[model samples]
Target: MPLITLQNVDYGVGGPLLLDDAQLSIEAGERIALIGRNGAGKSTLLKLIAGELQPDDGEVRREGGVRVARLEQEVPQQAHGQVFDVVAGGLGELGAWLAEHHRLSHAQPLDEAALAAVHARIDQANGWDAQRWVEETLTRLELDGEAAFAGLSGGMKRRVLLARALVSRPDVLLLDEPTNHLDVPSIEWLEGFLKRWAAPGGATALVFVTHDRRFLRALATRIVEIDRGALSSWPGDWDNYLRRREERLHAEAQENARFDRLLAQEEVWIRQGIKARRTRDEGRVRRLKAMRAERAARREQVGNVRMAFADAEQSGRKVIEARAVGFAYPGQPQVVRDFSTVVMRGDRVGLIGANGSGKTTLLRLLLGELAPTSGEVRRGTQLQIAYFDQLRATLREDWNALENVAEGRDFVEVGGRQKHAIGYLQDFLFTPERARAPITRLSGGERNRLLLAKLFAQPSNLLVMDEPTNDLDVETLELLEDLLADYPGTLLLVSHDRDFLDRVVTSTLVMEGEGRVGEYVGGYSDWLRQAAPAAYGASSAARESAPREPAPKPAASPRRKLSYKDARELERLPARIEALEAEVAALTEQMSDPDFYQRGGDAVQAHGAQLARAQAELEAAYARWMELESQGS
Candidate 1:
């Protein structure tokens, strides 16, 4: 049964319809992704489905006994109360109603029977256990046993709110950009959690609105796109949807082109002394009319967003180089140590590590925003670096988008160059009207896109971006990837987005703690295999650390022999081998899983380890078989 349904819904303002005659049916256990431009009514549609807002017209119906929960943006007043109390408040209204009903039922003086009934009802509803669930949920969210909620950071507080909503265990869950401020690790954890939460036959149906392509591709089984007040449906994952969308766009463009050609032909015929004989050649006219009708029915493709980095003067081969770089804030040990790396011209390097693992700090080192506690930070002669901080707070909130990109200063060449700021903004997909809207009104994703537009507008040979894809919509992200791929200058990017890194970067600079930067030959996937050997297997780790050994010839029986020693050693071998095999199998399964492909390095590494372990296991099995045969002989 459909958990919720929207019939011919219309949502709009004084200007135009934001969501037109849209119809949606959300099934039980369906994981739907809501996608659209910033002001395309994705959020507004979510509100309508959650019943927080009524449709401008038409009806929204929910299945009987279905419960919906939305992540509340405004923390309730009681949210400031005890953490336990705030979670309990989800059931507070129900509890109060039940208590009143019981009181009314007992017309006479309060009796023991009446009091027992009330207590029993409360226990059955699990109102008293709200604190327990709060603790468990918070623990899972990595906010367990915090000294106090008031002291928690904004990101932590958002986690608390998520916990409260999750503990309610609603039949339908509505999350709006749930990963807004979550670091890479936290987002990974949340992805795993949501998968379990919305597993087949699970009680929850998830409808998430997010610009995170990885998250959407991992979680969404169905994608609902809202565009210009109209809704369209796509079956399967985001990749599949994109493929189909592209095909549709191509067909539409061709059909429109054909119509345009026919129109031109007719105009030419009329100009060349042809009679107005359309009435006599009715069939031909009808065909032309049909073509025109079909052409009108098809909508034009929304042009891909443009991103052209300003041409900057070429720098020396080595742009930024750090030698034995280490940084530590006051009152703490070093956060990054021995971080040495060199970014060369035309190099596309991705910086990756756990959150607070110094990815940003490394970017800072390159930008000269922070001084290394030890070692040297050097930039080659004529090096030009442009940095994009993940947080867009540095942007102008009071001014419009165009003005923010303008930087309150007209384009002037520091070294014999001149251009207008408006011209630059246009290259980044800002229209005259859209660029005029205040930056404060822009959505997180829009603001991030705007920041990229502005940064790219300034000419620089080296681009140092920190979490550039954090809140960017998938469309914009893909466009950025295309731009970066074409860019001739140096690139240093810090992002947890696997797809972006794989598509744009040629090398990876890994900031593994202990003050060292691990420079790997390939992209993000290469870095992972080097980091976690356990992921491959125990033997693989041994082989990696030991000196390289040549492959034994197939006929070298002695080289392939298994040395059997104590019973304990023999007993452990088979079990260990089996465990390795199982690990390899699991990793293989994860890679094949559709969700894993949507994720970054984790899946690819898992897949690679699986292959490596399988090879080792085959070798081990062959040796074991040989030993058994020898013992039999």
Candidate 2:
């Protein structure tokens, strides 16, 4: 049986319908991805499935005794207790019982009956080990259980909420943008976790809304898209969904064209006037009116996000140059060091790393917002930089959307002319009514759109965007891709969206946690391939020389023909391998220390050389050991 079912659901009020006659059935162990344009009711449908919102006109049915847990985009403001207690709240009644039991235990003489009652409640809820489970889950998510919830950052708080939802281990999990505010490592962990949760033989089902295309491709077995108040289901992964959706749209267009032709013929018959009426064509007239009414009732498809940056003056050949740049806080170790890169005009560079790896710090240094502790930075005379902050900090909450876009000016210069602020906003798909609405009233995606509209209004030769893909809908994302592809300006981007990086970047700058940074030629996938374990054996120079298959190994000699010295060497190989591995690990750990980079260049180079030598020796020992084993020695 399906875990949750929504039959002919009709939602929303007097405004244009959000969901009309939408049907959805979520079966056990199904991993479904929900996608749609901004303001197209994806979140609303999740709420309905999670029982947070009821359908205005139809029935929502759930299997007997099933539980649904939902992780929303925003963390709850009231959950400001200790992190441990907040996550334990997922246990519901059992949490309350545990609390009461503790409270009564501390009272004088400890009421035995009260303790018994609490024990019974805990047993009934099957939550005797709930605290331990919550703590383990919190640790896995890299959250400190003992910390105060109010003291945590927004990202940390979101992680805690996610931990709570997972600790519950519900029959159905509904997640909305689970990857937002997460670092690359955290996203990878989440992907693995969800994959395990939806594995075969598991009763758990999932429905999530996300803009992370890689996440969709990894975990989604089916795609459910809400478009123009209608729901369509595609039974496959992201690539399959895209192919089928395109084919379906094309077929729909052809049918609409045929309907239009038939309507035109009916109009010609009606134009015959009195002669057609005298021929008793009343039935045909009624049929034509019905057809017109049907066509009028059909909803027009939603339009794509239209985005185009204003043309600006070209920048110099050298946009920005960094020479052995290093950055460190006062009396602290450097977060970025010896990073030298030349960014030229029209270079699309993507900066990527795990969280706290100084991606943003490097960007700030390049823009001259922060000075390097060591070395110098040079900027071209024509470099005019426009920055898009992920936080949308430039937007004013008190002002209306139109006012924010206009800043303090009465007009916005577009296409070499002064266009009215409202008219400019209309080009971005904002109606006059929506333009007059306060910024605080807009949804997250809408606010992101407004930020983009504001950023592109400025003319600049360099565009630096930090996590610009966050909170943007798919349509807007595609439009941003289109704009960036055609943009003539130098671009530097920091984002966790791998698919976006692959689509928009010509090269990638990777921050390997410590002060180490490496530049890769292509995109995110290219870096992954080069960083694979097998590829690690190949020196950086050799990998860059050209890609090729590994060479075949030589045939093994007979084990009985092995000499005494060879036998002794084979016995000692394991210890030698262990020592080399330990030494290499130590070198790697030292490299991750920011203080280690503060040493002079000679010492750093010596350490790197020694590490490389040890790795080479270890590889040779492994090869010999493998050859010996193949001979049954």
Candidate 3:
């Protein structure tokens, strides 16, 4: 039997039904990705399953003793306390006792009596198991139990919330947009944690809604989609689902076309007035009326956002140049250290780092918006810039979307053509009504779309976007990717969407840590492959060293004999090889230790990756060394 089943559920509020007799079953060990466009009822369905909301008509059946837990999309602003106490809140009454005990025990003036009473309650309730589970979950998610919850970054807070959910050890876990603010590493860690949390053959189940294509691809075993107030299940990975969904949509369209043709014929026949009424069969007339009703009730698939950039004159060949650029705030550590690069026209560069890393700072430095504490930043001539701020600070939240886009003008110029502001907004899937609505009335996705419409309307030779992919639907993201790929301008993008990075960026600049940044030739996946040699550090701790990050690893050009690049490669190989050997030896020693195995699968896998990377790097180093030696001879 399934852990949870929704049978012919109907739900909505005031408007069209968000769930029209939707049925779904979440089985054991299935990793289901609940996917849909913005406001397509994905979160609503999760609420229904989580029992946080009730269906207007129909049953949301759960197994008698089964447990369900959910990690909400947004981190609670009010969640304040030690990480342990907040996570303990996942458990009900017993958790309150544990939390009280923890609080009383930790009080500056230890309240022995209150602590004793809470401890007695915990013992009576058999809360020791819950205590242990909380600790284990915190450790698993790399959360510090004693740390302040409010002090954590957005990504870290998400992990803490996830830990709270996992502490319950529920039969089913529901996550909504779990990867929203997470960096690539954190996302990868979450993916691994979820896979380990459940089994492929029905041990524990997971249902999540996410816009991160890479995360969805990595974790989802099955896909559940909401469209036109209906639910459909697709069994397979993302690629498989895409192919099948395309075919399904194509068939649906063809069938709709045939039905419309018949409906049109019926309408024409009915328009014959007295002649048709005299011969019309009662059944035929009834069928015509039913078709009209069906057509009226039919909900069409939402249209894709039609995005286009306003045309601008080409920028100078070198869009931006930074020479030994360094920046730091007063009484703070360096946010950028000796970073140098030339951003040429038409070069699309992606900036990636952990949540707190200084991608935004680097962007400002490159754009010359902020003067570097040291070094020089120069911009080329005729630099028309269009910036998409991740914070959406450019948006006028108090104003309506149409006013925000058009300001006082009745029409906005896009791609060298004049278009009415409302009509242009419609191109981005915003109806005239929605366009006229205040910005605050739009959902996160809609706000993002409106921001895009406004951003793209500005003519530019360079586009700088920071975290623009957040809260955007996959279709819009893909559309943006398409637009960027064909764009003829210098682009600097800071985004954590790994798939988006891979699909759109031509190069990457990653902040390793401690103000050190490394540039790579390709996107996030490429960075992973290229950074496999563990350039940042042997371990996470060592990555924070305060040194100017090494320049991009040098590559040798094709030559009959030893070239200057070949000599440079030869010079670096011994040290590279030596470092790899040391890493391998250290990893090997750590793995041999009996205690290493007790750290769990995460540690073991990490060490395995380290060793594998070391060996691969060693092998490559040796190959280059031998080739250089031969060339010298």
Q: Pick the candidate with the highest TM-score.
A: 3
| Residue range 481-502, candidate 2, lDDT tens digits | 9889988889999988978998
Error of 2 at 429 (Å): 2.0
- Give the total clashing residue pairs for model 3: 0
Better of 1 and 3 by lDDT: 3
Kindly report which residue stretches of model 1 are placed more than 4 angstroms away from their true locations once superposed: 14-16, 72-126, 139-142, 150-158, 258-299, 407-424, 514-517, 533-633
The candidate 2 region of ten consecutive residues with least summed lDDT is 533-542
RMSD of each: 10.0, 14.2, 11.1
Candidate 1 lDDT over residue span 154-198, tens digit each: 556666777777766688899888876565555666777787788
Compared with the true structure, the alpha-carbon lDDT of candidate 2 equals: 0.80
Query: How far does residue 328 in candidate 2 sit from its true spot (Å)?
Result: 0.9
Residue 164 displacement (Å), model 2: 0.8
State residue 206's C-alpha deviation in candidate 2, in Å: 0.6
Residue 179 of candidate 2: its Cα lDDT? 92
Model 3 ranges with Cα > 4 A deviation: 273-276, 533-633
Q: Where is model 2 more than 4 Å wrong at Cα?
A: 96-127, 139-143, 150-155, 408-411, 415-419, 532-633
Per-residue lDDT for 595 in model 1?
48
> Candidate 2 clashing pairs?
none
